[model samples]
Target: MSRWSGMPRTTRWVVRVIRPFLQVFTRRDWSGADRLPTGGYVLAPNHLSHLDPFLISHFMVDHGIAPRFLAKDTLMTLPVGGRLLRGTEQIPVYRNTEGAAESLQAAVRAVEAGQVVTIYPEGTLTRDPDAWPMSGRTGAVRVALATGRPLVPMAQWGAQEILWPYSRRLRLLPRKTVRIRIGDPVDLSDLEGRPLTEDLLHEATDRLMDTLTTMLAEVRGELPTRPRLDVRTLEPPRTTYKRLEP
Candidate 1:
């Protein structure tokens, strides 16, 4: 059984308690939820805020799937936060460190065990000043390809409006509406059995990004004049332990 199978029922109940409050602050409307597989799969969503995981996972809760996320390893050192993450089966990625492979292996095992893994392919929350999705990395692509699982491309908006990235403060003024749209499963069947190459990886990554861009555009009610391809190379900062101390 997955280690997280033991997650206290109260944890989900607690989330439910806060759900209405979140909705009041940022009304949520999710589409294409049917596309999410109840069994093993990967959820690759555009990262915009720290709330992305909780927001997406909330929509996914009723589907008999609990999201196991790829978080920065330093989060594991936090007093209670680390225990909570482990209890929820979140995989920790040690950025720019040797232990990253181990984290990847843990994610693979989770998928193999029929759990959904949600990843922010951009690695960090969007740095797009405007809150657009940053350039994605190949971690999600590699995981999906290696596991042969469907990649559900999720597009989320308004999260940044709720909790601005890299800010010490939250925005309670705007009271924006958060919308999450899940696109159809990205078919990677074409790459199956083919040798994994740089071209293949890039193509797959681009396809995922394209899907996300299209979805986000729909939510924002705007279209891109030109294809923006600036990939952000900055890594996510280590999750600080001090913040978790009581």
Candidate 2:
């Protein structure tokens, strides 16, 4: 029996359909699957390409935990997307709406239920121009601190070569290398149980991003020269990829 044995029926069906298509164009070079906990924990990964989610999912399934994501509320509203997300037990965040808290609360529930909850701390694909992970949002930090769970920082590379972020072009003629690695859970013991303040949250959030960025730099074989860009403080660049979903 595999971890995917417990995956929602819809997730299994969808993965079955999608895996063959993806495998034809991509190959995996994943490490640290053994480091993944057999129980609930928060998974924070760098967002490089739109297709990276599925690549991450593939690794999780191979290792026996079904990865669940905080999907956009709009995706939940679509007939097909909604059905698929719901069927696969994906959580939706109603951003900027009164239901935003409910979305986060749902994620906490999922983790308590022994599910591996996935969040892109960057809150969007990196706008680093070089694609180093941008400054992360505070959602991942808040959830981990509230639940007192281990936050696993992960880094991935090579997805961008398959389908570049925002480009419609597909270079599937040659199989692309898809690499991923998971590091030890971040130790936030110092900040746990403290009064939740703006500064504390930012400090905790930066730790996650910094650990992830360091791991990412190792994966890329180069150090990042640019600082993490705060998209909130910056103007939106002209890019076709999705960003900042709640």
Candidate 3:
């Protein structure tokens, strides 16, 4: 059977609904689609705007991969939205609670099941004033390690142009061009089968972030003006999801 034909009803509905709107509203410049795997893999993308998930999902579904997001638990608790998310088999991440560790275990299972699970290593939108990717947490790396799935680094730019970070207002006028570039799976060959130490996770996460930043810069055709913002250095230590933090 065709891949779309095998997709859950909710996932098909999402593709039918969101993909068309994105195609109509924005110009797409997607590359490196050949890098996407047919089997289970961890999708690590840089988070730019709230609209990012839809755009990334569109790219994945168009290429015949059904994306399962590691979304906030609150999104999974919504009345209508929650049902759809559950029906589509997306994973819920319970942050700052006892259930936090459970989400990581769930992601590992999904990968082992041969499903695409997207995790924004940043945990939330970029804190960079220039919209560059910031330092990432280790949750994504941990999942990849446990399941031995390809941790793919995906970079997308221009979504922030349509919807700025933490801003509710959206500018759809005169169509914005969003570019998404996918890179080959991150080389975890050396670290694979090693003990999951704190320093090891951080190293893997840093490599993932560096690949994302480099890919994003290539898409934007310029280098980042400042070094990546490390959330740990903040006086208060800003954290979006405790479950994903290093």
- Candidate topping TM-score: 2
lDDT of 3 by residue, 35-62 (tens): 8887888999999888988889888888
Clashes of 3: 0
What is the TM-score of candidate 2? 0.93
Runs with alpha carbons beyond 4 Å of true place in candidate 1: 1-10, 13-17, 225-229, 232-246
Model 2: residues with Cα > 4 Å off, grouped in runs: 237-246
TM per model?
Answer: 0.85, 0.93, 0.92
Higher-TM-score candidate of 2 and 3: 2
Candidate with the greatest lDDT versus the true structure: 3
lDDT of each structure? 0.75, 0.83, 0.87
Locate the minimum summed-lDDT window of 10 residues in model 1: 237-246
At residue 14, candidate 2 shows an lDDT of 83
Question: Which pairs of residues clash in candidate 2, taking residues 3 or more apart in a chain or in different chains?
Answer: none
Q: Which ten residues in a row have the lowest lDDT in candidate 2?
A: 237-246
Candidate ordering by TM-score (highest first)? 2, 3, 1
Model 3 misplacement above 4 A? 233-246
